[model samples]
Target: MVYRGPYRVRVEEKDRPVIEHPNDAIVRVTRAAICGSDLHLYHGMMPDTRVGMTFGHEFVGVVDEVGPSVRNVKRGDRVMVPFNVYCGSCFFCARGLFSNCHNVNPNATAVGGIYGYSHTCGGYDGGQSEYVRVPFADVGPSLIPEWMDDDDAVLLTDALATGYFGAQLGDIVEGDVVVVFGAGPVGLYAAKSAWLMGAGRVIVIDHLDYRLEKAASFAHAETYNFAEYDDIVVHMKKITDHLGADVAIDAVGAEADGNLLQHVTATKLKLQGGSPIALNWAIDSVRKGGTISVMGAYGPMFSAVKFGDAMNKGLTLRMNQCPVKRQWPRLFEHVRNGYLKPSDIVTHRIPLEHVAEAYHIFSAKLDGCIKPLIVPSAA
Candidate 1:
């Protein structure tokens, strides 16, 4: 997938990636996912999203080649690469904060390197291509367990891990009431993970009915369509006995729709970083002193948020890009135990040739595309 600017992408022939560093490995992608975050770049929401950039972060592949120093993985090994590109020896990585690794993306202090995102994320070509150059192979890529389904392994690379990380960030305790703002894959997984963490009740809010249905059946959570309520926050408060939810997770980011002013200013006008509707709702819907976990991706610019209310209410705000590798062990157990099936959310399997159509279908929300995987080689 080559980005040609906002809403313009095409399948173009590109050179196969080669080992560029001693720690690097070349991966021939077999399964790559089109994530919701990719939509930000697709709609031209993030800064520095240049043309001709590839746009997939969640992928599983076979190692075609490895540099001299790579001993953990070799040629022909099936591997699942984390979205984060980190060297593992950095100060943050040493503390298990892989997403904030300082060595990979020295240019940006706010975030670490990421594959296929843009120049802002270390300019690494993403795995949406047939081949990707994976830096820090020993730290980032793990051998795919033979017992795991390929679809499950691919989803574990980012989506499932992120959702589990989001729930962990929320600090959910036994019987906590959690509200997740979005019914997309991340939100669905967050809701499911909340149960594992002992959440007494999980409520998913979205505008789409199909997703809400998925939330109900898949996550076994209560579902609400925000479009049905005149004041969703008010309803949330009432439903929670006026105290509000114990935790609120903002799973929707950038292009969220709810307030007309927020939508126009953030998405259309390019004045604010990204739409703050979901976050603002989270603040209003959570109880005083409740926690808010932000798994949603926001831009580098400013956003008009309800900072004063958050401060006054003493809300505990915890968020970061998921340290995908750090969350894998628990996810592996969860998947192995049959507690989570990450592939259950995959609604489309598109070949690389139809990536443009896949992007269109996903961006347009047509064909009930809850999740779409790109089959790079059809292998």
Candidate 2:
């Protein structure tokens, strides 16, 4: 898929990538996901999003070729690539902070290298095509276990890992009440993972009833539509005995609504960074001294957040691009034990040829679309 401009994507023939470095490997993409974050680029929310660029960060594939220095896996190996592109030897990578690797992105001071994100994220082509070039192949691509399902493996590349990371950031203690804003894929996964982290109660907030229903059924959390309440934060305080939740998570970024002026100025008018409604909500809804985990994708620009309120409340704000490869071990165990099924959230399956239609459907929230998988090799 090629980005023609804002709100436009088209599948076009492009030159197959070749190994550019000794650590590179080429993979024949089997499965790829259209992540919600990709919509930022799709809608022109991210900076340096060039035309004719491919947009995808979640994918699983079989290794078709490998550079001489690639020693971990060879041709025909099935692997799931992480979203973050990092060199294993970087200072941050040495500290196990692969997402913050210093050497990967030319714009490393701002953000790390990511697959198919935008020029601000290192300008690497994404995996939306029939094949993708993977750098630092040995460090970033994990071989898919024989017991792992393809759909689950694909989700691990971004969505599941990100959600799990978000939950981890929340630092949920036993019997803690956790509130997650947004009922999207990441939000649902965050709520579900919170239970595993010993959160006694979980509540998910969203404006869409369909997604709220999903939050109930999939995450086993109480659901509330923000539109149904006059003030969702006040309602949250009341539900939590007027003290607010023990932890709050922001899964909806930039495009979050509920504040008309903020949404219009940030999203439509491009005056500020994408809307901060969700982040601000997290700040206001959490109890004093509580934690806030942010997994939402935001632009590099500034947003009008409630930092002062957060400071006064002593809230711990933890956020980062999820290091996809790091969470594989625990997530693998969860899937093997049947505690999670990442593919259960998949609401649509689309061929690469019809990616434009899929994007439109997902962006417009038509047909109850939650997670859409792109089959690149589909006939």
Candidate 3:
């Protein structure tokens, strides 16, 4: 399918993507997904998304061919592609900071470039098609063990990795109390990561009952519907002896209303509040000297940040767009050892032809959608 225009995905006949560079590989996509970030590009929210760019970034595929220089993967190897393509030797990659790679994103991001994105990347096509060209394939694609299902491997591409990043940034540790501020896939995964990394208590706050329920079961996170409670801070105090959580993750970025106030007015999902609201809540809801990690997508520029409140609390704030390459290698060990069941977060399976409909449902939360995985027509 081709992103012929905004809010569109039309099946088209075209040559499959090939291994064009010395370090590249070609993979036949077995499972591809529609991500929350894809929605931004679909809605024309991404400044770099352009017409004709194949739309998808999450995938698990089988290696069909490899460039001469490729060393690790061979034909028929099942692998999951990283969302961001990067050169391992770049300044960012050399320092274990893969999101800011100088070679792949010299002018913009420091570590990486996404497939299927337009000018911001190298205009490389994405895995939404039958086949995809993988840049720096040996360094970017992770071979999935035979025992793991494709669905599980898929999460390693983006959501799970992103959640892991958030958890790591938030300083989640043994016996620490952690609160994740969203119940979306990434939020749920963040909560899960906290527990995996040994948090003593994990709490998740969201208005959606279904997602909250999912968080409770899969992540073992205590759920609090923001709608039921009049004072969220009070609820947190009741649970944590009024000291608040040890760490708060602002996974619901730039979309709500309460950056300065402790009180939050309930609004529909993806509406009303933005990142500021969650940041403010994190500040108000966490203990003094606690950590705050923000992983939700936000624009490049900002008007003002409440440095005063953040400083006064002595909160250690860690914020960044995901650097998939940095985390993928470490994550592979967890997946291999059966330490992470990241795929449990998927709540829906959709098809490519029904992508537009699926998008509407997932975007509007029309159904009990958690994370809807999209299967291509050919597959």
Candidate 4:
């Protein structure tokens, strides 16, 4: 699929990718996902999202070729590639902060390189096509475990890993009450992960009833439709015995709803850098001195956030692009023990040719589309 502009993408024949670096490997994509972040690019929220660029960051594939210097993975090996494109020896990567690697993107002062995220994120073509190049293969591409399903492997590339990282950032204490904003893939996964971290009660907030129901069934957490309450933050406080939740997670970014003025200035008019309503709600709903974990994607521009409230409350705000590979080890254990099934969240498997339709359905939240997979071969 190729991007033309906001709300426009079409399938087109493209040149097959080749190894451009000694450390590179070429993989034939088998399963690629339409991530929530992809919608930002689709809606033209992020700057430098050029036309004709492929947009996908979550994918799993079979290695088809490798440069001479690549020895970790060879032709015919099944691999899961993390979205982050980084050199393992960089100062940041050496310390497990792969998302901030200094050697990947020319503008390394910002977040590190990412696949298909636009020029701001290194402008590498993504895996939405049949083949994609994997830079620094030995460092970022891991062999898919034999027992892992393809759907599970692809989810691990981004969504599931990001959720686990969000929970980890929360520093959840045993029996802590946790509230998660957004019932999207990351939110649901974060709610489930909070349980693993010993959260006594987890609540998910969203306006969509289908997603909230999924939160109840999939994460086994209480669900609240924020639309029903005049003031969601106040309701959250009341439910938490007026102390607020021990931790709050904002999994929604840029295009949050429930605020007309914020939506008009941010999402509609493009006067601000995405909507900050969800972040503000998370800030107001957490207890004093509590932690707020942000796994949502935001532009490099400004938004009207509740910085004063956070500072006065002594809140610890932790956020960053997820280091997908960093969270895989522990996640592997959780999956093996039957505590998580990442594929259960997958609701649709569509051919890449119909990605436009798939995007429309998901962006509109139609028919309970939680997660959608793009199968290139099926095209």
Model 1 lDDT at residue 205 = 99
> Which regions of candidate 3 are displaced past 4 Å?
4-6, 106-111, 256-275, 325-333, 336-339
Tell me the alpha-carbon RMSD of every candidate: 2.0, 2.0, 4.7, 2.0
Model 2 regions more than 4 Å off:
256-271
* Residue-wise C-alpha lDDT for candidate 2, range 196-302, written one tens digit per residue: 99999999999999999999999999999999899999999999999999999899977732245544454466554577788999999999999999989876445
What tens digits encode model 1's per-residue C-alpha lDDT throughout 112-227? 99988878888889988899999998889999998986789999888999999999999999999999999999999999999999999999999999999999999999999999
TM-score of 3: 0.88
Cα lDDT of model 3 by residue, 267-365, tens digit: 112222234656778888998899999987654323356678889989899987788757766787787877788777777787767666777777777
Name the lDDT value of residue 127 in candidate 1: 84
Listed in order, each prediction's TM-score against the native is 0.96, 0.96, 0.88, 0.96
Residue 50 deviation, candidate 4, in Å? 0.4
Window of ten residues with lowest summed lDDT in model 2: 256-265
lDDT of 3 at 215: 90
Clash pairs (backbone) in predicted model 4: none
The positional error of residue 351 in candidate 4, measured at the CA in angstroms, is: 0.5
lDDT against true structure, model 2: 0.89
Model 4 stretches with alpha carbons more than 4 Å out? 256-271
* Cα lDDT, model 2, residue 290: 97
TM-score of 1: 0.96
